[model samples]
Target: MTLTIEGFDHRRVPVADGVSLNAAVGGSGSPVVLLHGFPQTHLMWRHVAADLAADHTVIAPDLRGYGASDKPADPDGRAYSKRTMAADVVALARALGHERFALAGHDRGALVALRAGLDHPDTVTHLASLDVLPTLDMWDVMRGASAAVGFHLYLMAQPPGLPEQMISASADAFFGSFLDGWANDPAAIPSDVRAEYLKASREAVPSIVADYRASASVDVEHDTADREAGNRLQMPVTVLQQDWGAALGYDAAALWEAWAADLEHTTVTSGHFMAEESPAAVVKALRALMAR
Candidate 1:
């Protein structure tokens, strides 16, 4: 019943609210669930997951709206909220026999992990977020042309239908833009892996847009509520970012400290895609966090 890298199997797990997720399981130690960034799949963790598999059971899943997972049409704008997605992770882990496990997310997945910490504190032992800010702080920091780096965030945050329609019109370009710009070294992403990412994202445009749209609205509400309540992540938290704030007009560490109680914030000089660009650094950071 144990899964390993050489013999890994991907399965579709059904969670509450009729959403099913594609999850890959491997390794055999302390459970560590991994969530990937936008326009990417669980595949984002391919390198980091292998390294962690040496001492931790790694569970990487395509979020509800991405990859090979079920993309149920969003009717009320509720489907793509991080809270709902966080619930999916919680349910998915429980179904896999992990009542409590460490959780880490990159990009969009990091927001999901933050929500998981807020909504299901007892279930997530530790939280790790790579290259992202909380939903509220993200929006708060956006202003004028300076926010051009995250143009997609503003575009996707618009009213649901338009964004999805436009993105679906040219899936390759839309997804490829982030893939190219976010990574410091595009060559680091193998051609085959890049192709696979574009293919998967092309098909999941609608669901992906909806997921981003939620962040501007419902996700913001949840984040604001937690912030106003002075709620901090109850578990140990680790944040690794590319020093975007200094270059783009904000303080990364200060922003993160507002949410995490016990935190280890490190600014990485590597590309935005830290996992692939600097897997060893990523592994070292995660290990240090896990040890704490």
Candidate 2:
């Protein structure tokens, strides 16, 4: 069975503390929440979500401050933290009558999914992460030549308003920059979809930067606390990463195991935008995770 974006019902659902989230939901069977990466909105999951909706109840939401979701100012950087974002998902699920569900996330969303599993393990039964390492390991692994693989990490981590202001100046180009740099074949992403990502990200510039900016500060602190507390994700985990080792000279699978105990990690031959670049692969991986 194939699902199309047109099949889903889109609505703004209230979550926590009077905050509301814009979500795209469809299909039936077990629920699976799809979370997208940075600089892209829930639109990133259009293809995969539709496919999964054929089998499972698929819920794709624009993270708290991105896409059409309310962009509450990140006063004190709390709104952008993964902990808060995870809570939004938890509340959104409960509101939708799903106290427990399968959760999958890519890029920034993957981080949120990770936090959700760790912080709220009883709620997330199965977890899938695409194209990212845990926050602390991701920060710790950069060394020498491999450092170039994630220069944006440092660029966005700068103190205060600089990164946010610079990115907001020409938000279209700033957000679209990853599309050009990360894809092995830029043509892999349909031009219309690419435009949609840039358009939504460009509009949500301040909140988007605040999301990345939190990764540099409080996110690190949270990851440190998790590490010290020895709270590894107890749920079944499936991680799909690009082969950064061959090009960047280090194994990514090893790094991921440090964070997840029951993990099945592998590298996809496609680009960083795995879901967009190769939807079939993403679908297969998710199907495997669902089976697990």
Candidate 3:
């Protein structure tokens, strides 16, 4: 059986025409939507969601083109762009009776949350991004040998057929490699959860590749346009990231300051999959962001 957040109720929320997100929602006071990263599902937010549900309405959903969410074909490439995915998130919240709420995301979801905060400032009251940089800055900073760490990014960024076919040929090995290598404590993600991630990713290879492909193309265009227009995240923002800058030769905080007026950036000791490996710290940071 698939594992779920203990007390949260699962439902399909229609965020767009013929597109419904599989969301696990619970708690009360204020709403906070949690987004998962690549090679994972909303289940990645299991621990954090349960704790936040104690005081906040936590909505954790499998992103469009991921997990159990509807995987619409990306014939136009715009289908999986962060702009479109951000709209899905806003629509999800409004459909759940929230006109304004805190938004948080890990990995790929972080990209979505950043876009949402930029595109719908009034709706996202607070924003938290776990372990990722905005699309444009991300591409800019990755260079030389350090760029090797993001080989998958370049691989998936290739035109449609090749990346999908390559990943699909050995889906488990491809997706499982990240789940194993990126975690500081592999045990943090138990066997069952790891299996779930691999299974979901294996089944959604094309859509997942499309999501990343968009990040390299259209997502970069959107962020570039926003930067040129001097558009920034209008809400309070909290960023928790590993000390990637120290090795990658970029000031993570300085880069983020360019986009957020109210910013709190911290370098976490946890690995890339911090949400699962360091839930207490993740929860603490999120609570602090919401309290701001």
Candidate 4:
């Protein structure tokens, strides 16, 4: 069966620089934009988005290079940089008639949300990140053996050509590896959604690699400058992770504290894909974040 987010109206919203993003808009109260991570598309938020739609206008989009959205490749990888991606979502919300909105992101989308808060504090009311650390702290905390687990990070970070080719060579296996490995409960991702994710991932190899490549280079630069300037997210920020701190031997909360002035840090039980593996808990957390 073809998977779809029920009740949401899908549209291709044009943002800046002649780009159009595929977004699913639903619900009716305060706007809350939902972002998905790597190896998955906006479909990752079906459960949470549907639940939140009851009380919030949920806008779930395929980040520029992922899902059914436009993919524009850049030689410097700047186009896929978190800064640009953040701008896309901010523009996306604005075009949808929301000047300011609540933001929640999982994985790559979370990184974009972090940048959005840093760059557009006045626009993003609340920020919630699922299973990720700030780009700078992420590179900092991930050292020695802990880094090995993210071999894909290093692989995709290299100069463009090769990483794209290699992953594209075996896209399904490459994408499926994460879908299988990360979820504490494999059944949390239904077969049709899994198929959709794999199909999207396979078709988005180069653009996806560019997204990761930006993280290791330009993203780090953007994050480092913010940290050096003593800038932190002015809005309320909450983070939910799988307690990688214990395994990686760093205080995840303390690291996140450095970036967020008002932080609500919680360790989740659902591996990396918390939204899908445990949607109720994820929805409850976001609801609480917005409430605060």
Candidate number with greatest lDDT = 3
Model 4 spans > 4 angstroms off? none
The lDDT, on a scale of 0 to 1, for candidate 1 is: 0.88
Per-prediction backbone clash count? 0, 0, 0, 0
Write down the TM-score of every candidate: 0.96, 0.94, 0.99, 0.98
Could you tell which candidate, 3 or 4, scores higher by lDDT?
3
What tens digits encode model 2's per-residue C-alpha lDDT throughout 1-292? 2122677898899987757999999999999999999777887787898898887999999999888888888779778899999999999989898999999999999999998998898999999999987888777677787698687788777766888788778787877888888988888777787787887877887787788888888988898998898888888899999877776566788877878888999877888888888998999988998898
User: Per-residue alpha-carbon lDDT of model 1 for 3-29, expressed as tens digits?
Assistant: 223445788899976788999888889
TM-score of structure candidate 3: 0.99
lDDT of 4 by residue, 1-104 (tens): 54679989999999977689999999999999999999989999999999999989999999999999999968666999999999999999999999999999
lDDT of 2 at 30: 95
lDDT of each: 0.88, 0.86, 0.95, 0.92
Clashes of 4: 0
Distance from true location, Cα of 281 in model 1, Å = 1.0
Candidate 4 Cα RMSD after full superposition onto the native fold (Å): 0.9
Ranked candidates (lDDT, high to low):
3, 4, 1, 2
